[model samples]
Target: MTPTAASERTHLVFDRALVRRRLARAAWLGAEPFLLERAAEDMADRLAAVKRRFETAVDLGTPTDAVARALAGHAAVGHLMRAAPLAAGAPDVVADEEALPFAPGTLDLVVSALSLQMANDLPGVLAQVRRTLRPDGLFLAALLGGSSLTELRQAFAIAESETTGGISPRVAPFADVRDLGALLQRAGFALPVTDVDRVVVRYSSPFTLFSDLRRMGAANALAERRRVPLRRATLLRAAEVYAERFADPDGKVRATFEIVFLSGWAPHESQQKPLRPGSARMRLAEALGAKEVPLPPSGDERD
Candidate 1:
């Protein structure tokens, strides 16, 4: 889609009330506590691995105390800051990734944990991130990706098709690894890497999974949408469809969480440059001793 079209669609898809309700439910579901602890652990591990390389770091979309915990052991304490607001105890400074307040090339490192999936314009946000990094600066992020919540998507699709005769866009679409890598390249990030980690959790019923998602502040956030209450019959039918299609033989439904980890670097003049043309370039066809395939000339290039 064109940028304008995408922006309009994103505005229509994001529902603030749905997000608030999901956050409230997620807090009640103890997702905040669990996520905070996880973030702390991950940050500590990440810091230990890259402390010698980086002198400054920013945690984008860090919504809990994890960023603080991650920076606690780093010598760059003064440079550590968060970019999202949280509860009173959480470490945050209320920032958005799309329009970071930091000056260009000011950051040495940027980390995001389980964030960025909510961004309306992920590529634009990545560009902003790229602009904030110094040459050779590192960018690391984790976000929910495709293959996540397959059971939920299937269940919702079945329910809507059978009940409403149409499917509503409930869950936000996530980027696959390939698409995410391309986006990083498009944003001018160097040596971009993308990896997926699949986490499967079992639930006794579909309701249990739904409840967990709500507690995690993950729900439908589409704006300009109807808010009709789900009927009992529809709910039961959804549950049945979920169990029959997504359940294991043990009767528990499996929910897949595909976490995508990405890392890249800011371009630098000192970095290795591409080889000059006509210099020894490795051609796959030549290496394989295969005949070169002729391409159809464009209208402009035709003889």
Candidate 2:
């Protein structure tokens, strides 16, 4: 099938081209600093914890240079490069996550910060990352999680339903921790792990939150998102709903940003593996020092 036909067959979620444009505009307008600082610091800490030096590494599609800056002069990193989907961040190369430009087994490490959540073909991207890593190489990433932006989503839904009698997807869908862990394993990574860090940010109002999102290049880019501008009345109602529902006693509205971290290593012979089922030398009952009990037989067994 032609590439166009294949894309049509695939259930494309985010419009990647639009995403790039948004990010470029954000950069041109000087996006807010420290939007991804926490994630970058966490990534640096995680890498530091792993007592190994990566001879070659790439920062994949991070919207900002925070990750690169955080790892600069790090003892664990050598010859680090940055790859971005757009030319916004002065990256070492402009490369799309959907199609990485790395040779197989060429990289020792790959790190993505708050970027993979925008990928339409995330599993495919993960597979490509795995193929680019040398045996026992590491891939560490942070992205928005399913619980991210729950407040905005709910407020928008309520407002749109009441005003327009219909609702559109204003917030992009993010994968849950379990789903991401499974994706890592499917992408041929060993010892896959996933964890979440929920950050509840207090905003003066929903409008402030919206502005922050635009500055962070995280505005809606969903494929099925409404093309028309949001109606002013709808926006007001959304703000009202947000304030009424999610505002704290101190009058600050809450915005949730759940960052999910993923880490896995390319499989190697020396990597630890789970023991085969029923291969245990000792029974579970013996190991636990518990009395064994037999269950009643099923109908077939009784017969």
Candidate 3:
């Protein structure tokens, strides 16, 4: 039977097959995955301040298992498990970020490092996470933010537009800080908080950034991306544009990797509650030592 043409043309955003393939290749290169390690350290620090013990914890998407390692000897953590992409260093479990196989209310803590930005159905995945957590369970994660790879994205966009007469999704887009906070609430997480950690790394050249991204499994995997490989001229022009516009005084280019950290909790009755409207006994004037001015007369009130 002849193979269908449509199957060959169709591609999915953050294509799982392609991601696994690229990651497998990257594993052979022996490059350190620094981003994952750094984000894992941030999670460990944040967890230390929470002052709560989690008997059962899972570290998701941290391919290097850095979070798991950080949590292992900590007093607050009784056990630690790991889930990573199939091609990555052998995790305790292999799973997709979008689809987890945990039972509802089974977990006490869930943390992810330097992942989730690539999820096609992030809101849905978050909703699933909310359902998976036990009461008062914590969910902490750091994801690449909208500001990440701005230089690379811009250079690729301009180069593609100029050379190919159109621009495709050359670099993946990340979620905004506000949007992620709202998404947590929408996913039924209580007391959601979001903060940004902007990391500006100096690279000798754009190709160095590209090489790092390859090892980090942070490549463009957009569904609408052009099938044809980036033209040599386009790649060279992109490098030129990046160096010209984003280079520092020392000729090293600045590459920003903004990691947005999100923290939320499964709701419990003991958590803080907001006061209802008109519930305060003291007037605004009494509290602030200011007088309330009378409202201006409406047209109907005039004689």
Candidate 4:
């Protein structure tokens, strides 16, 4: 599908305003930035592996300056700036992910660490990033993947089902690697690549996990999320369920975070392209040195 069509078809899964508010609150509360720091380091390492240098780059909507700091003064990067979602972050540009404020072909690189997963129209945001890049410009990003917080989701679902006799959306949904890779292709990126990094964190209890999630600005911001706070009984039950199911032998509970990394480049003539169908010079059997066998004819063919 075309970019515009894809954007129009995207579901409004997240409450963007809520997400912004939570991010701001997390910043004010001095949220723990370990995840962003880890993502920034990983992205920096990946960029370092590439031979080319980028003259201009943007850190796109990261909650903090972790990515900018990791890449600043690097031999492969120059003139790095941040596009923050809120004004409090003191960003070079105040921009929304869905609508970037850049002219087409203006940037050499764009890196987003632990951002873009909460965007309501992720495809639209990716299309805008692709448009902002010059030919052969690179885009690299990491976002929480579908498997993140699976234990919490399971515990909450079980608790609600047992006590309340119903379940509400407690955790936000995240896209898987394959879907994100397809989005890169749909956004007109060349040589799109995607992979997952699973991070397992052990917490003292489920309550501790909740605290960390809030501090990370990752509390459920789904548009359809439950409005009322979970009942105390339900919360306690969930904690118990979590400990029973996901706890280690040492009595700590484990939380899984799946981080999905995506990298792609703007279309360029210098980049490699797939050969056209029927363009091969040799047969597969000949290349493999194997005999080719003919199959028996079908009944229709015999008739």
In Å, residue 3's CA in model 2 sits off its true spot by 9.3
**Candidate models: Cα lDDT each:** 0.74, 0.90, 0.83, 0.90
RMSD of each: 5.2, 2.3, 4.8, 2.6
Model 2 CA deviation exceeding 4 Å by range:
1-8, 300-303
Candidate 3 structure quality by residue, lDDT tens digits, 116-174: 88776787778878888999999999999999999898998888788878888888878
**For candidate 2, what's the RMSD?**
2.3
Question: Of the pair 1 and 2, which is ahead by lDDT?
Answer: 2
Q: Write the per-residue lDDT of candidate 4 for residues 15-69, one digit (tens) a residue.
A: 8889888888888878888899999999999999999999999999998999988
Across 1-303, the per-residue lDDT of candidate 2 in tens digits comes to: 423344456687998888998898788877865648999999999999998899999999999889999999998999999998654578888888777888999999999999999877787789889999999999999999999999999999999999999999999999999999999999889999999999999999888988888888888899999999999999999999999999999999999999999999999999899999989999889999999999787676653
Clashes of 2: 0
lDDT tens digits, residues 1-303, model 1? 434454555544465435545555665656634544464565567656754567788888754555566667676334677776442224446655455777899999888877678777788778888988999898888788988887888888898889888877766778889999999999999988888778788899998877777666776776644477666777788889989998899999898888887888899886677778888777879999998898897687755
Model 1: ten consecutive residues of lowest lDDT: 84-93
Poorest 10 consecutive residues by lDDT, candidate 4: 1-10
Q: lDDT ranking from best to worst?
A: 4, 2, 3, 1
- Best candidate (score: TM-score): 2
Candidate 2, TM-score vs. the true structure? 0.94
Cand. 3 Cα-lDDT: 0.83
TM-score: which is higher, 3 or 4? 4
